[model samples]
Target: MATWGPEVVAGAAHLDRPVRWLHVAEAADVGVMLTGGEMVLTTGLLLAGDEQAQVAYVESMQRADVAAVLLGLGRAFRTTPAAMRRAAERCGVPLIVLHRPAPFSRLTEEVHARLVHGRFAALNLSDRIRSSLTTLNLSGAPLQQLLDEIAAFAGCPAVVANLAHRVLATAGDRNSLSELMRDWDRVSRQVAELVRNDPVTVGPDGWIVAALEARGQRWGQLVLFGHPGSEESGRMLGQRAAEALAMNRLLGDRDRGWEEHAAESLLSDLAAGAARPEHLLTRVRAAGLPVNRRTFVPVVVREPAGRAGDKGDRSDKAADKEGLPQLLDRILAEEAVAGLVGSIGADGTAVLLSVPHDQDADAALERVAVLTHERLAARGRRAVVGAGFGCTVLDEVRRSFVEAVHVADAALAGPAATAVARLRDVRLRGLVRLLRDEPELQAFIERELGPLLENAPLLAVLRTYLKSGRNKSLAAQVHHVSRPALYRRLESIQALLDVDLDDWEQLTSLYVALLAHEAQQAVGPEAAW
Candidate 1:
């Protein structure tokens, strides 16, 4: 408008319309040369001096959706024609009059140059955003960081949610999460199924949504508020954000699904011992787990260890590690104590419950462990659930959890294949199991039985003597040897290990060594050295 020194006498409200391109035509059917959003800078001399022709001209430009119409005042019977002005006012199209003749070529050049510049700027901004997010994804940034990048680019709050509309990650200073969470389903339901990279605003507040998808599976959604750029640019930003999120999910472990992410965080944080009880309570509540139970018990369920041939073999462990936690969640839900369950080891899972304090929770916990074991077995999973003692104080639940894990470790390393092993049941075996990793304990086992181990005849006599509680006659009968033969073997054992067979203290020490040796054998044959 300034290039022609024009006056906008009507539809001044539409003057700021974005001009995407500039077109000039002298034909009576000038609308045929125009497209929507193009500023029609034309000298309408061909249809001048005819009111009906002027109306037809304005109506045609209106139909073409041109940004604005500029009429040369002299040839078009200037002085602001009423017919064209009324048509412009009716159609809400900006009408400008060039009082002094101005070349249309210069105006088109100026406006087109500005249009191209604006376009390049938008494209560059979008490219920079995509490159930044792609670089962040490659650098192994977490989901939250990616959301922050989107939020910063969008200049508004951003959130990541599952298809179920549960918020997984949020990035914003003043988030409308509680607001959206109130009517989340309503908003989510309004989103159309996106076949490609289509971003949509569900409502009036400019909440834009994009799908987080890969390999034809939609993992979740990425949403932003008050998206600042054009719809096309916003969509480009959204599609790239989705790709980055999918890449991040592919690169991450365990957090592949938001539910897994929630469980792992809850269990790991509580197991860390430094988490405050109130903070922990808040976390569990946020996870949609129960906190109203009377007492809390920690139980560890493990699939029987795979063949010790290669302890790390992961063939069947996937089923147990993935299935046990899911099963425990279901059982606990039925018991009305469904809460946090986590995979703690390759073949082990842990669950912490909140039960009533007054109830006999120790018995209830035992029942739960038993049911879990049976359920797992029925499912062809053969699991052993080691239950820790019940606790009234929530903070002490972590301690119980530790004890339960220790019990499970001992039970798995012991000869007994009990499905439910309490702390008390693993007593001596537990203590020895703690020392199984110690070089001193292994040395002690090797030192005491060093000489007699290879001499099977003498070793058998010594073992029987030990089993018979030092009753020489019982030892002789069990070994099928004469009293003199047993006595000779015991003497030989005592001399080899430098202990007196008559001394009760020495006998007790040797018995403890033998117990340790048995535990090591139960663990692995190589451990029995």
Candidate 2:
């Protein structure tokens, strides 16, 4: 911005592009003579009367990628040119009018000086942020201290969220942080995939998010609740924060932080009422998880199957597991659900999300689960989100969590369970799972399918036929065999088990036996009832 007034005549939105150079040119084809980012000044020497010529001049400027085009007035027909204004706006090149008969030399000098000063100031700021963060790192400051400094630089609430937008660490005033995080699931979903080292504003609130990445993989995000300054500053602040977080991540095991450990411990204890209600609230609040005050929806995410023995598959699974926490957090934030996510079991994540009371719980959970599956699929990972009960009371949360676990376990049992199942949908399988170790159930399974169990192929054929409800074509298709081949296997199964294939009552008994068998396989033989 030069001291000499250069009022914007059109395309003011583009003023955010910082002017890097200024050029005084009256030639219509001056864009060909300069590099990009130069705010070209013209007196319409060749564009005074011709509208086409003026439009062409603007087009050339656009091609050269100039920040803005200034049209000097008085000599160029007394007033600003309509052709030039429309051209600049149409081409998205800012049009600035020099209202007064100003000297070009002074304007050029002023703009150059300002640009230089701004660059140096930005450099100084980067240095300061780096210095402070480096000092903190060298002194072994906790992660929160680094985040606090970032929040200070941004001048707003700041948070660290796993890829799923689950808040990991936060800084700034508690009230303000709460306000910023409220309905964060929907808010965070508006975020775009951030380019490395580039910060982008997200949502209508102008919140800024930058990737916290290392070794070519992004683990989570650093967020400014509301960036208070120019995009340049936001980018700088985000980059600095990203650097600090990445460095800290390299220096420490972020997943094993005290905060994460504390959350896991708290959630684990909460599942079984290890503490009193009032004390639990205090602990939840201290851990930054909203509880007792909002409608909570418990969810569990787990891989669809156990890892294969292939090295490639194992590596991919490991990567997905490592990324799962971040992914869940990001989803909740994007869904605008006020949620808390933590590690649970060996390869699963758990979330306690707060949704609006009036929100459709089934739709919300389905969408959350669907989107989670979709996003994870984009990274070549298959995951399922099982939903539990939704409740307002803190005491009810434990039951909801337990239900979520049951639903997740059911989904893990087979492909038919779908990626997202509600507690109501999985109750039967859950019950069967719980009773898998009962001697009666074991005896029943043995009586029904014991003779056929010795042959794996025959057992598979029988299970598939039962799964299809004796639909010969579907079972044959599933088994990748012809109808005759499937019938031969069915006859063998019938001969071996001495069961009637056409009897619905016999089919029911066998189905129950198969369920018991699968339940044992799913939980593993060593698993206790």
Candidate 3:
């Protein structure tokens, strides 16, 4: 939108030869006028001094960017200096002198009108760009919407390419690009090489070729053919669009965080028995997670040693304390072992690890445990992990998880133990199964049998009877007590336990409780039932 085109010289008189448009200005400073690409316009008052100075001034104008000199002859010095005319001819600069009062007002009006037209053109282009961007945002569409809007504005076919130089989105006559995109399997090498080679302008087609790179990542290119717009302008707009798309992706990370939170909440409920694992699985599937028979690995995270001086309390803060369950979800999401892993336990203590197919599940569990531990460590906490044995069925997942927790608890009980133990490998398995957490039974035993066990003879007799499978003869033989003495010990034990010795279930319960107590006594306070 330059105001001074070559045709502006058409109206000016006293010009014998055709003068191409150069520039226009009235600055007294010749250097400023030249720098601004303006022709000099002034009366000959500059020639009022000596003739040599006049020749030097015209020579300076020749050396400078003054394309033409328009002198108003009616004002100031009324005549052109012969030295100035000789310098102009020598420098090949067009020189004209106006005798009558020149039409300065008309020339100013023309320049002003052209300047206004240029501003209007720029304003119009900006409005078009804003409208296109607004339409793209309003549609809430993907790449195609932006391309179509921009293409329509430029009156051309537009194409979006990915990092592989394959077209991701396209508008207008797409046959040229479609062949390359849809046939990517066949043309991947060619496309990769082509983009890497350089930006290529398709020949004779008026198409501009440019690359699409964002955030230091090369996303590919966008091409527009037969577009009636400046190539630089179009590239600038497209780059802005690319940046907006990347920003949208970044903004979506929050939504992903919320999803992880909801999934973790669901997992905690299932582990706590408030909800079933199947319920969580249902929701997972509904959310487009392909989880069918994922094995459950129940981990127990705890505080690390440095948290406080007291090492006895190894329990970490609750899983929900700092969105820990959600943290775990993000950690496991990118793992190869856990395709669609999530926590599904009460207290957010259990995780259901989904392994695609029957791969080496043990390795996967180890990886999951390592990652979980690392994450916990990073969070200024420590985790004690226990993975359940692999199960092919979902119904059995809950049971396996329960067993994993039990194993982990047992391992934690031993002061020397640092790692989780397999449920089958824990030496106290029998004792753990036998010990019941019924406070009523414990109270009855402590109240009634406390005095009997204090007496050595009565304790020996009771032990003999319990080990002999409730046989009186076997009790007497083992304890070296007479039949009558054995009868007396039986009566004492019956009174102590406050249960029928005749009933098999009661006798078995008492026997197991006694054995558990002995094991508990061996392990001390740390051995929990």
Candidate 4:
């Protein structure tokens, strides 16, 4: 109390150390009876004339890591002892002395009550945060909502970043977050290094980080930027927020694997239209995909038919399939393309390239295509890559992805000899593939090719003839038959169908029917109506 005229006599620099508790000890060797962080109060009754004991006392206090030593003036020397003060200063332990008589009991009672109250308040705050986050989690709140809540509690920006130091989501004031992100590339690297080296929960500059982990696998980190609170409380908030996120992820995708990479999750959501465009844009930006004045190119790569199991061994096929995403990622990185690459359906990989407005989008796509084909070919796999129209608006990115998927299907169905296939390249075949599910298309396929449906030999000859663009000579060579024999087969087919083979309009109809039939067959027999 001010009435007691308390003054710091030594080690004033260490006054900021936390006081875990208060202790009253008069024994010369009282350090053994106490734990660390206790502020010791004494009258110095035993060490009145012993310098060696005084020095030993301060050394023992230092060893025990006591918070400070407070000496009452009356019973001890009238003023602070030179030996003890020097020793305290030397030990860098706080030493506060009462300039007048002060009651130790009252001082302890007051400080202890305040300490208890503070601890109680902290517990309440912790419980409140935990309950709020738990409720949010149960209600199926989105990841951004959870991050926003955490940011509100922390009074600062919050960031969720993958292991690669890419931000996956962020929350808090836009201006403040923008300031933080302006130098995120450097800050994130430094923070990642610090975390790796020390693994401390509370980092430099009031940054509190908690690892998002489950079952001993860590996928990302939750960071609270510059929390304006005691380190203990900041760490509590961070750990609680991290737990909520991890639980949210676990409950969000329980059936599938929880270790889905961050890029894949974002791309998948974008393609599926499962999340709002604004939300997806936020995620895209946070995921480190360029958004401003950028061109978005959506591409899909499909594995050749029968290539998955071509190795014959199930494990080999599984390994190959798993490496597809990684393979695409490597190519993207090596080519210096800013993109999100991930697996789509069973045999397709999707990539969203963010090209700067100043860069040529076509050139970027061509570079990616060349490397992709070259790398996949090196692995004894030739994949078909289909790219959609490049767009500048983020809202239209999902449409691009859908279009890319269509182009990929068309490429698979038609004769695509290029490294990269676009919508125009697929031409009539692409149109048929896009509308292959139409009832009219199915009916037309049946009406035009119904006569040859059951006759395997004649159907093969007709398909070969149509595919050769009415070239009877090439059709005969392909079927390994004489021209006369091919003519006879064609005439027999014409007689069954009761249609003239030489009619231009009739030939065009048959060609479209073949395209539709092939497209439907590519999807499988179950899709046929």
Residue 154, model 4: Cα distance from true site in angstroms: 2.8
Model 3 lDDT at residue 269: 49
What's the lDDT of the predicted structure labeled candidate 1? 0.70
Clash tally for model 2: 20
Candidate 2 lDDT tens digits, 275-321: 44544443455466655446778787777544332234677667767
Q: Sort by lDDT, best first: what order?
A: 4, 2, 1, 3
Candidate 1: residue pairs that collide: 293-354, 293-355, 293-356, 294-355, 294-356, 294-357, 295-355, 295-356
Give the Cα-based TM-score of candidate 1 against the true structure. Answer: 0.60
> What digit string (tens of lDDT, one per residue) describes model 4 on residues 125-244?
999999999999999887767888999999988988878887878887776676667678887887776675222388777888888886668888888888999998988898788888
Best by TM-score: 1
- Per residue, candidate 1 scores C-alpha lDDT tens digits across 163-249 of 676657666644354455445556556553422354443333455788787667876788876676666667667777777788878
lDDT-wise, the better of 3 and 4 is 4
Judge candidate 3 against the unseen true structure and give its global Cα lDDT, from 0 to 1: 0.54
- In model 1, which regions exceed 4 Å deviation? 1-18, 24-27, 43-47, 71-78, 96-114, 129-152, 166-179, 182-203, 212-220, 228-230, 245-258, 265-322, 344-367, 375-529
Q: What is the lDDT of candidate 4?
A: 0.82
Question: TM-score of each candidate?
Answer: 0.60, 0.49, 0.33, 0.59
Q: How many clashes in each structure?
A: 8, 20, 9, 0
- lDDT of each structure? 0.70, 0.74, 0.54, 0.82
Q: Candidate 3 or 4, higher TM-score?
A: 4
Evaluated at residue 170, the lDDT of candidate 3 is 56
